[model samples]
Target: MSTATLNVRTGPGLSYPVLTQVHRNQTFSIVESKKDWYRISTDKGEGWVADWLVTRESTGSLNETGQQGTVSTNGLRLRKGPGTSEPVVTILNKGDIVSISETSGSWLSVQSGNAGGWVHKDYIDLGAHSSASASPSKNKEAKQGVITAGTLNVRKSPSLNSPVAGAVHRGNPVSITGSVTGWYEIQFGKSKAWISDNYVELSSTPVEVPATSSEFTGKITVNSLNVRSEPSLNGNIAGKVSKGEKYPILSERNNWFEIKLKSGKSGWIAGWFVQKTVAGEQKKSTSSTQPAGEKVTILHNGTNIRSSADVQSNVVKRADSGETFSVTGKQGNWYEIKLKDGSTAYVAGWIVSIRTGSGSESSPSRNTSGGIRNKVITIDPGHGGRDSGTIGTRGTLEKLLTMKTAQLLADKLKSAGAEVIITRKNDEYVSLPSRVSLSHYYDSDAFISIHFDSIYDSSVAGHTTYYYRNYQKDLAYDVHESLADRLPSRDRGVRTGDYHVIRENKQAAILLELGFLSNPAEEANVTSHHYQDLAATAIYHGLNDYFSN
Candidate 1:
């Protein structure tokens, strides 16, 4: 479709109610069209926007206008213009939602759902139109079968020792037919397979235990850690839970434990570094009862295998074998697997596959959630403690200032029910690596570094959002525009920076200099409580703009 710019209109050269403003590089959806006007629906709501004001940079939403309601995810954009040459946007949050209208080559007509604006898809998911559905729903039919015992091989192929495919959880099911030595033949529906007889517990009738609740399954950080009761260090140890272990989460009480393991084993696991996995995430295979020998191939590169999924401190290796590994456990594709060396590894979802497996591992790529999409954001407060970033004229330490701003942003995000992470809570020097590490470590949706601007040239004034990556440009633009509109400072405009913090960072990364500290007037205004809150509000809205679109 041909791209257009949307102007929220009141009269010629005038606009009111504003409903919401779509800034440069933000995206939106075109629900309908009329002469010189486009009826647009954003994360905000549906409204009539001027076609002149709407630019090709504006993106549409996931809900396509066509029937069958094909969802479009590739609409998020980081843009210079509606054109590809525009310096790419960067630092896109993981779950930033966009409204896609049409596309050409690499350019996508888009807008942020929350903060309305036009942006290009240079650095975002440029969803291509498809006539077919993405995939069938996983819950359509829950197949029932018997469990085959032993070290069941869920191979990509129906073979044995075929690179030792994944194992079946202790009580899952399978359709047993015959046996080959210690291995038993099973029917995995369209395919038949063999699995070891050591690990499974077989039952004919489908035992109707209370269906697994859609509950949080908290994590265990250590490669092999034990679950225990009571908060005290000397509490009673319940059982050992492995890394990436999804312990059925009970409720949390202070620093203590509360969990439910397999087979109704309920107790507490320590609350440090362990977080419950979100529900609907622990989706069991259709053949949960069948220990089929299914296999998977590495779909992306740099898939990390760890001693455990707990900490990155123990990375075993970057994967090889484009190896067909079995899926022992899957919680959002951060699968738990027994490595070729009998170790464990955490493979990101995008890097591997269970069917038609053929792909390379070790390449840098990002994974998007299949459904129930939510935004993932990482907020970094620049400098802290002794490393008081740039000092302001009024003696306000940049670190202190940004920390307060960061806190405001964090609170706003949390209140909105979004997962928010602040790099530092106290005064302490945080290495740049650590900052980037935190974002990459979590496979964050987006990485935003908060800071105030300073320069030897005191005349360099106003606020500017710096982005090194193309995908982050719209984010910078939306945020910077929000700040300019909310605060009294002149818009320094979003610009490109080669700052190490933005450059080296892998995820969508942006650095904001919230007005120049060297300018007494701007500095004075920024230091005010109102301005601080204003900045926070702007950032929040900018984020909303990016994700809501």
Candidate 2:
């Protein structure tokens, strides 16, 4: 599971384009690992994310720790805390030896020569030391299994980095003797075989019960899902449930859940598609209720609908591509939809397109409930960590000022009922394309990038709002007008910008240049807490107007 709003890139490095952005608590299975990155396999496809940004869920029963590293850079400071502002305990020069004890994001707790503190992990070169060095314990209970994987690699040790001992194909028989951290210790030809638990299915696979009582429930996060007869993908589909449907989880088997269906029969669902919830706890699910006068359009062809109260029928609805029919009534999972011929037929509600009848081209309807309430917005504080951005004449950092302003705005936005996703939560350099990818990943209603401008010419000074597309012009105008009315700086006016954050964005994205950091006087004014509050408040007011009006 990711601990922050992290980018899953095409490759392990920042140079690669971002494939998608995964937020906090979203888990994906790791297929491979290289250096400080993990190759994650999702239903969408495979991508890579920095290991520091995520916490791995070990389905296995053991955890291995302790790695060795050497300092890669000279004058790397060992700080009292994980941040740059923390006091320096001691500075270590090039080739300094250290032990990595803990990790907090990009920072690693290092100990060198009787002195221990936190240092950035980028400066430490970790060696190829194997994890779980000790051999896994032998399985006392003899077991048999069939290799589910097409070609499963038998490793010399439990670690993925271990040398390949042999290979086993599908339909091959295996004798299991022991296990460790999700790896099976099997008996191989004259040697012990260590295989990943994910590849093989034992006759009596070890069942790990996640919960026993009805205290744990699950909420369907996907638009539609199939409830099955058993806990595996091969199980027959017993029923279908739309997003936000809740069910009491009866038990767990191999990560799948046995849920008590509404009809009282227990059915299995994929655990990954459902968000676990406490039974008595209330969660504010995403908007699913239909707005008045809005009709429903079929999302897929040959979708099922109820022909009678007891039976379902597959019927085709005739309409133009993007056309919607009036919804006369809702019956269970079916909607009574009026056809092009003026005759009404019941259509499956889960397979219908969700679009507003107003047919908006200027902006996406985040929620008809109004304002910024429940709207997902992305707020990006530009240039951080290694990217210090522009430096003011008096030593003021543009990154620091932008972070301050963004945080204030984030606090206000959260208070006003907005679900905000911060591109960089701290002093971390986020790639420009990844920031844009985050907006699209979350389906953001609006994306705002906060920045401070600078140049060789200190005389130039002002605040400006920039939009890349015609659809973003309205948002730009609203925010710029508000900032101009409130700040002492000159109004640079809203204009079309060619910046990466907005130019590559598909959502309503805008960049705000709060003030010219190169101008000593302007920098002094904008960096003040009072000025930041005013700027943040103005932007908040502008967003409110844009959403409510």
Candidate 3:
């Protein structure tokens, strides 16, 4: 038989029914042949398939078709009809060969002897000598756009401030057009976004709002709140304000404020620290007042801690002589002490006798700062919950892999004398921005994100590291170099990336693509425990280098 390649045709026109996709190979049985059509016997029943898609044998047994090997991998669901949203009839498992009865718009109408429905040809491999090549058609390049606001962010996804892919300063234009969830879609303007929808914006030409200096009215809430020159905590403190005083909000910077106090002292306060009143004055919330609890006088000069635990780890700050506090509860040798400034601290139980009500039940040490241990190192295993990051071959989920590697890395870091803090301990998804926010919440010394890589071409494979901006390049290099040396796979070489989570982070950050999951060999290696340990070790060493330097 002169073997020929099969052409999975979609109707007469390629427009309405697009050639959805092609399988590597599949089988077929021809019952009747026409000029350009063949009525084939499928498991479902009789159906007409395009004759152009079949190659025949010289013996003429199946001059246009051949039977492919049968084995069960996944079941195929029967569709009500052809097209994208067709309803499923039922799922068919392997070992069952259905007859191909007809073809229309990329769908092959089939029958399993008695049962029948249409199946998208691409999903099932039909054994036929096909001359066609399986490759992705070139997609039109999407144009990027500019950031029209004072500052606009490119995210890991289309949502607000998703882990920042990169940032566009005021007036800088970007090439963005695609959109998802009310946000413009951008993939780092190229393949760099390996993750889709990594950049977003409202529209290409956003309505410009003039940057006019505006004043807001509100009351000061804290007794002695430090007013800063900028919104960030690191911003210079312009002055201090007394509680219950009124101020005019001069301008806004995210959650920070530019304000003028009633006493004519001008400065900025964290927006979260004050609430705007109806009269335009800012009012302090309950931040300045202490929570309800029985006051206590320490008997042994109570030492203030972060939680009600005496473990060397429990102490974040120490209470000095004459420090008064309200005893909220108690646990082994520790009391939950509330400071006069409304902040809660844990005090040593041996130094303070409960002067009032008993303390609350002692919770797990891990529940609150791990019950005062040594030092806590926060670890983020990146990507969870609805985000299906760069999918790899054979269904290796990045989220699962990252979590596993993170856990391993945490253990290694802990063994080296540091308490580990894991932002997420499960498979639940978390946004990139949230991951960064959580890192700040824990004040982690370093943050690492683990992930796998996927490429359109299966041949491209290796590992790489990414860092946002210049400050984190050293961290990226350390992790990348360590991974290259420790991992058992091929190194793609460490390169700089504008990943949002790493770039926007104020703390040291590094993201590692351990290996390309799309690459069969690399994918298998990444799934192995041995490789995971190597990855963990590399990351640990990288952190050590970063901190040591």
**What is the per-residue lDDT of model 3 for residues 1-549, given as tens digits with 9 covering 90 to 100?**
112433333343222243333332445565554434555554445555454344433333212222222223455666767765875544455544554545666766654422356676776566541222221112333554433233344444432212334344332334443532224444342323211221222232322222223433455656678888677767797788777676666666655667876667677886544644223111211111222455544432234456434232455666554455766543322456667677776664423333333444332222322222244466777677787677776688888888888987775454344667787889897777888897788777767777888886554567888877677778788768767765546788767777887877887777778888776545766787656765776676666656555
Which sections of candidate 1 miss by over 4 Å?
A: 1-374
lDDT digits (tens) for residues 1-549 of candidate 1: 212334454332223456555555565666666544677676767766655444534323332221111223333335535554554332134444444545555445443321222353444443442223321111122233333222234542222312222234333455565543224555432344445433333343553222356434565656766666665445688777787766666676654457777868776665654643333223444344223554556543444565543222377776653576765653321456656766556655434555422433232111222210245678888899779989875677888888878887775454344567778888888898888888888877677888888776553567888998898887778777767766556787888999877899888779988878865445766776546666776787677666655
The TM-score obtained by model 1 is: 0.33
- TM-score of each predicted structure versus truth: 0.33, 0.34, 0.34
Q: For residues 19-41, write the lDDT of model 2, one tens digit per residue.
A: 88888888787776675589998
TM-score of 2: 0.34
The models' CA-based lDDT, in order, is 0.56, 0.69, 0.55
